[model samples]
Target: MPADSQPASREKPSPAAAPAAPGAGLSAVQRALRKLGLVRDIDFALYLPMRYEDETRVVRLSDVRDGEMAQIEVAVTSNEVVFRPRRQLIVTVDDGSDTCQLRFFNFYPSQQKQLAVGARVRVRGEVRGGFLGRTMMHPTVKAAGTELPEALTPVYSTIAGLAQPALRREVRSGLARARLDETLPAASDWQPAWDLRRSLNFLHYPAPDVAMATLEDHSHPAWQRIKAEELLAQQLSQMQARNERAAQRAPVLAREAGKESLAEQLLAVLPFALTGAQRRVGEEIGRDLAREVPMHRLLQGDVGSGKTVVAALAAALCIDAGHQCALMAPTEILASQHFGKLVDWLDPLLRSRGLRVAWLTGSQKKKERDEMSAAVESGEAALVIGTHAVISEKVRFKKLALAIIDEQHRFGVAQRLALRGKADAGLEPHLLMMSATPIPRTLAMSYYADLDVSTLDELPPGRTPVVTKLVADHRRDEVVERIQAQLQQGRQVYWVCPLIEESEAVDLRNATTTRDELADALGEAVGVGLLHSRMPTAEKQSVMAEFSAGRLHVLVSTTVIEVGVDVPNASLMVIEHAERFGLSQLHQLRGRVGRGAAASACVLLYSANEGGRVGEAARARLRAMAETSDGFEIARRDLEIRGPGEFLGARQSGAPLLRFADLATDTHLLDWARELAPRMLAEHPQLAQRHIDRWLGTRAEYLKA
Candidate 1:
């Protein structure tokens, strides 16, 4: 059932921010159900069981085996409250063959009365063997003479105040009332053995004779149908978003013939030539901008791949067409880096044409912000670059044609839409989003299906490969000696800590303490600076400036410097508790160095727990970092480790779009969906729209931006 098909009284809230239903005289259970995003019959119909309970038969107590889940029928012989370790209620039950003890650490008065001595009851739980014979820590008790269920009982995931029985009743009612009409045409080639209605019915209450293993691992035919439908819905929604955008109008930024375009001029003035990959992607973007429709292209490359130069070229092209371009970065440090690089590359060229570059940030003083806003509004600033402040309501654009977002995954859906909404009325600006964290192929096909992707697969010439090494925490002294060696050679170093200050929750190194320690270790002659998120904006800028100017020998900071801070003189990176960081983050931090021709190295200093070893997942991340420097490979391994939700970060607004189909293991199904979606939309437009509405509803908005 589509959300739009529900009654008009229901409110649609995102899963993460699910609030109480907007109505009078609602029960606590109803409110709790709303928190789970179950406001519609379809929401309940799609909320499948996490697991099932076997209530089809009862086994004798003598036949119950240890380490196995079983239901046994017995009479309660004794019940008492005991307090040895703690207060508990213990009931001893016996059949003709054997006796078992049922313990409950917490019990209510109703439960006590129901389990009175000599009462017959049927209990279900995991059987465990102990000194007192067979026992169940907490068994579910029920009347003994009731008829067994024909099918397995579903155990749904629910919030407090909504018990499993209550939820089961609601799910059954919703399933009966939901509209399960066939959305796919009968002639579809991708049809599964089970239809949509049959799949949901079988999944919600499976037959007792079915293979539990297949159901648990989601390998059954019913599960396959569900995953296929989900994948198809996602594909349809993304295709719809793309088709709708094609109908909108945007500025045609094609270059004029017989005139040297701004991009060509910038290319001529660049100190370094563009790599083959850069030129290829640049051409791809150039073609998109030339079209009448808005360009929604993603530019992805590894760190040190010279993405900044490509972005500068794109900006130049936009400016050459007599339109404004805005570049937005997530953090101030990264935004400042882009600001400095763009100013150096285009400031003189823009000034020659009576145009200038403007910078804006949240930390800017009132007068500075006002000046930047005025320049932007007056169209004097042909190229604007800043942090989130660039999207502020006060900063209006004049003829905004293109918007470039760096590290786009760090931004939320609302933020990206806000930037895109800054364009003039009746027109949208072409979007060119750049990311240093290369997106894997599967991820690109699914999450980014709506946009064209351009990949800079190769780094620029003369980039040194950084050697990665893993060291235990006990070897901190040796890492210090290595840093000293770099300093001795007139090179700089970056010591990155996970935490900014002392934290009682985490027992890891802090930036402040590390800075002090390194300052004392290297003596007062060496200039050591500390940088973190909590520091004042001016202080962070000053510290980075000093480091870039070679006045600071070492810079100790947090992951704030992980992405875009560049210093050619820096040759070494030491990450404290590297096990605490993600694979992409570690790769980005290592990329901070190795920009210049100097040979660089990254040291991953990690600590072990009381068991004398790091966690398995953490070990995998460290091992992957040491084995490969390829951003694509790291992203692949990262997807395998963290799944797509964490890999995409805030891109999905904290809710993973695909709940059934997995991009990694279900590639075949995903390919089928991708192939069928376009055809369905073209041949059976009504069915495609209904399918998207039924599966996505309000959640489809996340993909549009």
Candidate 2:
């Protein structure tokens, strides 16, 4: 085989081969490999290391430094079992110039025999300062004359009972037996300098002289090549999905047939004007609705960017065309909020035009739900807004032409597909999925490339910039005083806690406790209400209604109120244990306030250690929330902190799992892949599928959504 070509094989194994079931005859190493989801030789070969341990050369004990990992060969001068504080094995080792102590809190009798006095051994671990000069606690030890690696050792993510040496041996065997063919076409203008085989070889067993920084940073040419290939495979998968969706037929929802259509009339009655971004996105949706093919579009906006209005306009287009429309929210609170807003904004105008609006949620009484169901089935409800209840099997639509899903990421692709299935026979409804979480541009290009995206980048006029403050839990009284001041001014406040009830496992504050504490602090002059997921739907709705009506001065709740419980008069937000929440969640919780023009403020009260310190990641999240109200920036930072897989949710399971690519730093590579993927697929169709197979394996089925 050529240097760039894969090793030759008699026949290629299928990428989608199922793994052997438990109880089947398999070696211990093979079972361990299966546990890591690597049943095939190819899978084992592709299971890259999490990091590398540079054990090619041993360091002198005299040259060891604190806070740095070192591998050294030394003679065990003394070995003893210490039981003063606890039973521990202490082995004092000395090289030619300096000495160190190896302390093991857990050890077997066999290890004791191996660490006999005057025995020569090799140990690798971080050198830390200890009372005995230098110490290496729980260091990996190997007897003298054992085979040592000549290159950087791969350290894989493993489960219990799976030793690193055993795993490495299996991976090495797999690599040796694996035969791969070139997935991408031969070198072209856009191709990287290295080939697939060379890149994998470099990644798995880098040369002894290779700098650790080069491998760790993932900036080496070989790593960059592999990253680009992975990104390109993802791009190709998304492009295929986009093309497949485009091939499907859909209902053509033309504009309302009149000088002033229902949409126009509704817009005319709006108290405020639409932002430029909203208008642009509305036009985009309007174009998609006018088309005969199914529309798969994502409307992403910052929290409170008027996505609801844009969706309402799209619903109007469908309704005006003699069809029903449905909007599904993730939670009952959000569904009720949408129902109320649509009723307030479009009720009079739509009612005058002889159309009706209805809502159905899980919490609705049987009679009420039946009435709504009948209204929907009989075509009496022109616009329906609800939670997942709208997509239940018992509920049917008369002429569902459009489905708008709010907080689309919160729902699975299957739910969206099920909603589309509700359309009339031989017609698929145009789908508009809305997300308040602003997806980073790189993710949108790779993960959501199949859907047409419209961004509502501008906030409406009179929207106040929320002043965010990160306060330690020690200053809880100060935050409570500020809330009292806001309440005294007739403005409501939202106090968000991470937990519904105190958990013995976690030390975070709970909504119930916080509510009672606030009530006690504020006294009878302030009305305090508690809301959480554990509360019944009726009670939750009642508390929310009272809060919205200003009957409650402080509404303490859990993340259940994170998304869509909007109250313009609620100008103060206090989130307890804010560090426990994600950046986007913090942003959304903060969005609850700043909806009004009364100088809104959001106080993030976080717990600190006795030293008044927080975790680095948690501190970064709080700082990001305070630095900017821009959801996109926060989302980008969140992605940097949490990564793409978590930010995009499980729907990304089908896309290629990036081994070397950092979405934040390798965005340029993603851009190149996005630009080249379609062209590469069009020009080299066979190679494109192979490339996708190589990266995604059987996971390609995930992109069908």
Candidate 3:
């Protein structure tokens, strides 16, 4: 590599210089580069190649093997257009050792003119056996220009109108203009083996002997250094955001005269004792509620781990303080379920003290909604439970102090912010976000870095482990018979289907069809009810109510019932086409059962193998479900399969984003960065800012959001 093809040397720029101006000239190439969100020279330098191709060692045509990529330097002996099976331009090239044919299905007149007879050309492509001993199809052709590159060539992600050669040239130009300054102190113990500039040089132009596996696996020292720096930048940004949020003013819901007694009373009336994990997490929330600074916390618990009871205790504290508390759910069914459960538990205790519980959902009648709104505004409703309807402008809290969001990932950041804004002027409400879908510890560190996290790791006593079994679709009759037997024993059943309406595109069972099939199979011997998202809210609620009350023997529905519908007597759950759902979703569906004293089992019905083969990914998911009932393990597998992007829901600005760090494999590096971030920020703030600018640039705002 030439020294001139290196970045210029200079001190690192300030925050304002992060977004550099685009280079002049080459308008077409620049336009395509802009599509990749690359504008400055630094941006291009950081735009790492997806893969590298070794083209430095040219080989003889006779030595080339089929399915192998090779670079050949030869002189064209003849050029002709052939039209037997298709019109193509065939150019015969010969080196001193042997000869080969270069075939192009789509050729232009300019290409033909360029590949005239007796012209020397260099080509690189995969070799395949053709009519002529060995052929290189659609090989990249160029006039034998200056000597071939002596190092591995980078194959970058490109856009239309930007050929590989063009991209290579522009990237080389960007590299020549890039100037990197050390973002960390020279005395730091966490420094990389190579300097920033040297690392970039080696990454872009590795030696001819460099192993492809090193670069591809990202295990090379250079790549590891880059990953460490990226993780450190993310950690620093999150720490800064946390500090900012902590500085904000919030309402403090200190206990009134008898708030502690009220909490004790509520707990006393519960059917069972609180588990140790629940008590610990509840105390964490309690401490946060007592603070004047807003509480931004995430309460994570596995299904049936009693997160609702913890949240109810938090609400009791707020209610006892004479301030209104609102609990928001992602869906109407979930909201209704929470409302009913809370009323059952706290209505008796709260109603006697002139404190009422209100329910607001999209399905409520206009008059009912108005009444609820008025009660909330007058502060007569000490506790309010609703879906997104609670965040609407029409609803207001007279003395809102705490906002609790359930299934936190299901709601958008904006919606959560909107609910927080509902509090009184100059007072920020405390936020308690709950998620039943437990995230892996490594992921939670980055995903929920801004919030204090407390995990309810223990399930309440009397909760039996769910026995999961994978049943092929061919065993449908047997599974239906088992369900019938359970129903005849007076135990309720839940049959979950992936889809509500039939989809031609997807060859999976639908809820409606499954309901009809079950009805026919049982034939009045069991009471079967149908439930789906498309049905009227009232009708669905009625069916759910009947099922919970044990009037309905079996309820068949879609994934809408996956979350909040709970019945202790519901001992059996049948999931159709379980392979279509993700691991966390499967776990949530299975969580619906095993909530009661009786032993329970979950049946995962999957499509029969195609030609005696099932997809490896789907097989792993089913095997994991059958192997363990640990929600955290399921979450770890989910992260490994779907990655952090989908697992965290949709991408949003200011969210934590990693370009080089793999949460599955680079967790050790993440841990190192997490440990070092605070100290680095405290002692060397400028260097920390530079690191952030180098890795995230304008996108650092995503994590802050």
Clashes of each: 0, 0, 7
lDDT of 3 by residue, 324-380 (tens): 899999988999889988999888888898989999999899999999999999998
Score every model by TM-score.
Answer: 0.95, 0.90, 0.89
Cα lDDT tens digits, model 2, 1-705, are: 443244323223322233356455665655666667766666667778888888777888888779899999999999999997999999999988799999999999999998999899999999998776899999999876677788788888998768988788777776665656576666544778887778777788887788878788889998888889888888898898777778888888886455568788879988889999989999999999999888889999999899999988998888878899999998999999999889988888777877789899988899999999998999989999999899899999999999999988888767777788899998878889899899888888778888899999999988899999989888888998898788778899998878634472242335567778889999998899988777799998999999898898999887889998789999999998898899999999999998988899999999986777999999999999889999999999999999877888745544455666888789889888888788866777666776777677767766766
RMSD of 1: 3.2
Model 1 lDDT tens row, 545-634: 999999999999888899999999999999999998889999999999998889999999999999999999999999999999999999
Per-candidate RMSD, Å: 3.2, 3.6, 4.7
State, as a TM-score between 0 and 1, how close model 3 is to the true structure: 0.89
Best-to-worst order by lDDT is 1, 2, 3
User: How does model 3 fare in lDDT?
Assistant: 0.83
**Candidates' lDDT values, in order?**
0.89, 0.84, 0.83
Candidate 3 colliding pairs: 7-178, 653-702, 654-701, 654-702, 654-703, 655-702, 655-703
Q: Determine which window of 10 residues in candidate 3 has minimal summed lDDT.
A: 8-17
Better of 1 and 2 by lDDT: 1
| Candidate achieving higher lDDT, 1 or 3 | 1
